[model samples]
Target: MKKFSLLSNRAGALFLAPGAILVALFVIIPFFWVIFVSFTNRTLLGRTAVNPDFVGLQNYLALFNPETFFTRGQFGFSLILTTQFVILSALVGQALLGLLLAWLMQAVPKPLKAFTETCVIAAWILPEVVIGFAWFAFLDYDNGTLNGILRSIGLPGADLLLQQPFWVIVFFNTWRGAAFSMMLFNSAFQSIPPSYFQAADVAGATSFQKFRDIALPLIRGHVVTDLILITMWTFNVFTPFILTHGGPSYRTELLSIYTYRVAFKDFEFGKGAAVGVIIMLINLAFALVYLRIARSRNKEAEQ
Candidate 1:
């Protein structure tokens, strides 16, 4: 029995070793390295050149200075804009729409459900660059499909890309990403027993009431998981860089774009690392909030 157990333990470690090594190599090591780099005055060129000196929190201080952060077209504004984009596009747009689609799918016929699932999955699996280019063409000013439709209907077509760049990107991200959330919710909903819904119907509960009282409570865990995943993904997304290029005077320049500009474009490696640290902290904050909410929901469900 001892010999057999030893072999089983060795087999389990073999399966787990690959994933553990990859995480340490990619996620864990890089996370601390970025933090270490943030405290040094690193530069790709000029006097600092090859060797970087320790500057403590100078990079952070400079980044958060009154003029730098508060200025209309600066780091502070970029952070604020990115927050808005994540909240609206990921939290509200994708989460709400995906949940609705999942609920709607429950009542859809099998044929329609399969077709819709295929379409949604197709969108989800397509390359991010392809989605960006597709949206770019769809929203182009003059000869785009959207403008063509507007002109056919005797309406004046405006340059949505230039006029509403931020919202356009938000909508674009939501459309491309909602399919994941929808599939997640669908899976969660499937695990729910139908007896609860039947009981609610027998009690003469309305659809909204049933959803609020039954589905919401049961799917709380999945909702929390889906939101955290989408929020992080949306916050860090660089796909819109292909579409908007963070252009139109930096109006849609998210924090990730801002970090890229400061680090690579400006050759200020230290400041960029500081920005990277800040974004990491922000993501950490989101994860904490999600975990707290999930914990509370779990406690309530247990009671």
Candidate 2:
């Protein structure tokens, strides 16, 4: 029995040891380091945290400052408000767009469907810098695709990045993000049983009625999943801010960009760490809500 137990222990370790070591090195260690560094006054180029004082709560306090973490001006809001807007706008827009694309793809022919799917996924898989540059050039005032098209229609020239920063950011996010939702909803739609739609048809249900009563309910799980996942992505979106640099007088500044600027640009390591922790907490909340919704759906499925 003792020999058998020793072999079993060795087998278990063989299975678990590699993963455990990876988790410790990549996740656990880095997380603890960030937390530790959050208590100190640090700089970007410094060998160690400057003034290594354990200033408890100071970093957190600075976050609430009217300008430091948020509005760079007198406004009482900035990162939090802008971040919420980005999350909501991107998630809702993408979900709705995905649902439409899913339904359309279902009705379309296979060849066209394949072509569209390829295009959408290609966009999603494209390098961020490539897309970022493409968007930047597209939004440029003098030699932009959009401006050129606008000029053809006799519209005035204006650098969209400067004229409408928020909407431009929102547009860029939605354009790039809708494809993931399309993929998610497309899978959900395909997973739905065809018999139900046939049954609805035999019952003389209208197209809208069938979709409303059957398709939407059946795809609820995918919708919830997409929303949660998209919310997380949109929340952590730094690419938008990086391309825009939270620019045009900080109109496009969001939490992720704000944290990056604080930690890397301003050299306030502790405050940056605080911002990073807060972001993790916000993402965690979204994750919990997603899990709860998924659990509820599972119960319904079982019943």
Candidate 3:
């Protein structure tokens, strides 16, 4: 018993030590630094003054200030609306599309399976920057592939990008990003014990009943994970805003873009950091909810 305990202790240390060190170095250290910076009045200027004074609560208080550049009161309101749009567009849109694609993959013929899976993976494997640029060209009003097709049909090609910033970003993001959920749901769907599905089918279940009763319950864990990941990614997307430049009067300004404009563009390091910290807190809350849901579902599964 003593020898086994010693061996187990050694093995645990061998694996966990590196991971613990990394977590401390990367996550804990950076988080402490951000907390420290938030309590200071730092600037981006080259003058090396000790301006990041230990001004406690000043930065936090500035969050409520109206005239403050970094914690612009208006950005808070915008963020509320921004979050709503992104959460709806990403979570709902991705799930519906991903499930449809996943189901379709199962129904498609064997010869075509390899081709379609490759296409789905090809989209996911593309670099995000590359995807962003490709979408830019595809959506460009003057020389866009979309407009080109409309013109080929001898119809007036509307300036889709200029006219619909909200839907444009939502559409582009949904189109490019749905593949992650697709792959996840596909894997989850594939892993279910065949008996659950077969039982459902034998019970005179329609396709919808089979999906709702058997498919959704078995894949709920993956669904929760996808929801959390997609929600965080969508809300924090800086790439789309960078490409769109939050144009057409800030129509596409999600939380990330709003924070960027505050911190870097406005040069309010404290206020900017405050916004960042607020966003981090929001993510943390979502993470907690996600874990809770996962735990509850897991407990139910075990029972």
Global CA lDDT of candidate 2, please?
0.79
Q: Give each model a TM-score.
A: 0.87, 0.88, 0.83
For residues 1-303, write the lDDT of model 1, one tens digit per residue.
445464587888988999999999999999998899899988899777578999999999988998678665588999889989999999999999999999889879999999999998888999998888888888888778899899999999989889899999899889889999999999988999999999999999988888899998999889989999999999999988887878888988988988888889988888899999999898899889888988888898799
lDDT of 2 by residue, 36-119 (tens): 877776776665554566888877777776454344621124555556656656666777877788788988899999999898
Candidate lDDT scores, in order, read 0.90, 0.79, 0.77
Q: What lDDT is reached at residue 202 by model 1?
A: 99
In model 2, where is the ten-residue run with the lowest total lDDT? 68-77
Model 3 / residue 180 / CA error / Å: 1.9
Identify the runs in model 3 with alpha carbons over 4 angstroms from their true place.
Answer: 1-22, 46-50, 53-55, 61-73, 199-204, 297-303
Name the regions of candidate 2 deviating beyond 4 angstroms. Answer: 1-7, 45-51, 66-70, 73-76, 152-154, 298-303
Give the per-residue lDDT of model 3 (tens digit) for 1-303. 445464587888988999999999999998877777788777677441255667788877766666643332356555865676676668777767887889778768977977877887787788888888888888788898988999999998878667877787787777767888888998998998888878877889987888888889878788888888888778777777645776667666777887787778877677677778888998898889888988898898899
| Highest lDDT scorer | 1
Count clashing residue pairs in model 1. Answer: 0
Error of 1 at 242 (Å): 1.3
Query: Global lDDT for candidate 3?
Result: 0.77
Please provide the root mean square deviation of candidate 2 (C-alpha atoms, Å). 3.0
Better of 2 and 3 by lDDT: 2
